[model samples]
Target: MQQDRMEARTAGWGQRQGWGRRADGLARAGRRPRRVAMGAMLLVAGIAWTAQTLGANTTPVCKLSVCWASEADKLRYECDSGCYFESNPVDVEPEAVCNVMAEATHEGSFSYMYRDSVNLVTTGIGNLLASVDDAVALPFMIEENGVSRRATEQEIRDAYNGLSSQSAECIAGNPRRCNTANSYAGENALRLEEDTINQLCQTRLANEFTPGLHRIYPDFDSYPSKVQAALYDMVYNLGEGGLSPPKWPSFNRAMGRKDWQGAADESNRPQLGTTRNDYVRDLLESAADEEEAGRQRLASCASPGFP
Candidate 1:
């Protein structure tokens, strides 16, 4: 069934004919485009193998078409169903990461600017606009007399300043208070489109948090999806520096040794709600279960076949 699905999806690309003709011409010229050929073969085989080995219930991580210009380009980057791959392949499903973050950050309520707990201007799943420049960098929509238009730099700056100057009490769990006519509502109201918010989140994860995660956890890509998500959550919630060895020594030590349960025990944060803490702990525990199952599988494989 998985192979059938894969074949059905690839059928359209195969029918393009242009690719076939190009391949043929290159072959006839004795420059066989081996990398393209090899990449195509690997992509199909890899997807099939991954689906089979991980079981039908498992989500395929790399379902996007391979569009690399060369083998070197392939090595440097690859696109996935929901995220862009960097130099190192992201093992955890990008959708899973996004779901975890969206839930933890905004609970699926994205759009509109608001001040966070610390009275810092924020929007779109905890995206912080620390300065007026930060606010102006992204596109924001402003509504005037029921018509929406793109906000100018001055409007964005004014909104940022207005939100930034609000009292902590007004911002503490009161987004509506922060969005009054004076600040982010009516003529002064500024909002981000959902697509822009999602793009912003993805770009940050790909460029900032994920790379920092790889530096601290060299074997990150080899971990189970749950483990990777848990670690990624930590890196996202707390910046890379906040979760690094110096800041989180115990947790870092547990992670270094692949002690999922130990990491779970050390993963609690006073600032985060209990639900969020429990979510991280549960993910780590689930990873511990996966680790134990893997150990049992290896042990069974090592036993004599005729025993």
Candidate 2:
């Protein structure tokens, strides 16, 4: 009886060991496939991320080639194939800064004309009558409903036709003539005026200053957007031609040298007065400082790699 009990006990032990080994092998087999699937998923995700990064780097870059729309084609379109200026919708970064500065300096008005504090015949935001003789220039485009685009010539012509002799007269204190005497000055006329002013402001900057700046600095995009804004205002106040020659030789020289502070100081000259010169200088420097700080912050940070 003792010998039979020993043999039976040994057989049961062998069967248990065999079952344990099979279970361990099955678990390892299941885990192998799980590990491979996880690695495959990671590889695919890495490839997609790399592709996205390359696409972002490949976005189209633009630079102004033509100065302004020719008399033959007074209107310019956005994001078109040609040079940056001829392309529709100017560069997003600098254009925003320019628009804000201009809007702040010049008030929006429809058929409203007055002698600015500087005693210039000014109409609309940044449309100096002293600089541009006609309120409406040809080949100008207006976006319908203030959002979508409308035909350039027809809209401008309609706005022009709506005007009477009174609206046409944009002289000093007699600005009220359009308010009372004209059939225009309604919502439609105001929309047209706003469109015209916006277009002209952009065109003048493209035509006059952008190309020269781009030529001088390869990394012109890195410059403070406010500098572009200030320059545009200068163009608006003083014609593009006026930026050079007898009036601002020092300022022009400083700009040619890429001397930002020197240009700012030249801009702050007392002759132009604190209102025009100081205001613009502050705008330019502050914008530059802001852009620099943003760049620094980006440089200091580490990339947050794919989760």
Candidate 3:
């Protein structure tokens, strides 16, 4: 039946129908609505059978150093002595580390210009423009310059140069924006402010979104890191309120069931035209593959009472 649907897709008939050679339409035809509906039905049926046989919500036992708990309705694991339950994926991994690709992605879409059309100077990978009131609120903003004025372009450059090398390079076209020892010391005040602001955002995001995600998906930890990261990005960008059913019904529906592909489709809607959904889907699959390989290696090692 699936094969019949595959064969019935209209893309292959494009040439015969003189629809030109740009068959980009066929590129993602596998995601046809009917096919997705059928696949979802099969998955639900399988899960239902498994639940009936194994009992409802019976999570598998945990291994060493992994403990599960529910908070604000989210199921999470406290691992390696860290309370890494529900938090924005961006916060899970530092902006400097996690979602590097996503940030770079925005650079391409938004361009690497110093300032936007509105004359807001940019700095970081997401271009962290000065136009955002939050940027002004960044602790790096100096009040007692004795002049009691907004930071000048030079001051902004000096402040950012001290804290983030990667972002500074992207912004200033110089990897060593603050190379000299004296140069570094000169920006000490600004650097302190930058660190404070960074910490503030992290704290705020964790407090705001962590419990909300817990409420949205109780078994959040069981989800692939990529999926968690994507969800974090969504909430971070749109806020918990914006991520609700009225704003993103399909994403909410697919995500509620851990249907990553379906969720990806919902995220990759044509109107949005963003690669975030596909990126997360790929990351999740890649992470799963790596884990499977690690398990296979461990199994091989454990043969004959451990090598």
**Using TM-score as the measure, which candidate wins?**
1
Clashes in predicted model 2: 6
Candidate 1 similarity to native, TM-score: 0.64
**Among all candidates shown, the one with the greatest lDDT:** 1
Q: Write the per-residue lDDT of candidate 1 for residues 1-307, one digit (tens) a residue.
A: 7665554344323213244346667878988554442234344445431211222322222322334566444432222121122223223544446656787442344577775556766777668878779888989997789898999999888777765455555556554454332244343467888788888888878788878987898655445557777887788788888998788899988887778899999999887778888888988887676555544433443346512
- Worst window of 10 by summed lDDT in candidate 1: 78-87
Instruction: Residues 60-153, candidate 2: write the lDDT tens digits.
Output: 1222122222422211211122111112222233344346545443333433444443445444454565533253443333455656453355
Give me the overall lDDT of model 1: 0.61
Error (Å) of candidate 1 at residue 23 is 27
Which residue pairs overlap in candidate 3's backbone?
75-218
TM-score of each: 0.64, 0.40, 0.41
RMSD values, in order shown: 12.9, 26.0, 20.0
Choose 1 or 3, whichever is better by lDDT: 1
Clashes of each: 1, 6, 1
Q: Which parts of model 1 are misplaced by more than 4 Å?
A: 1-91, 104-109, 164-187, 304-307
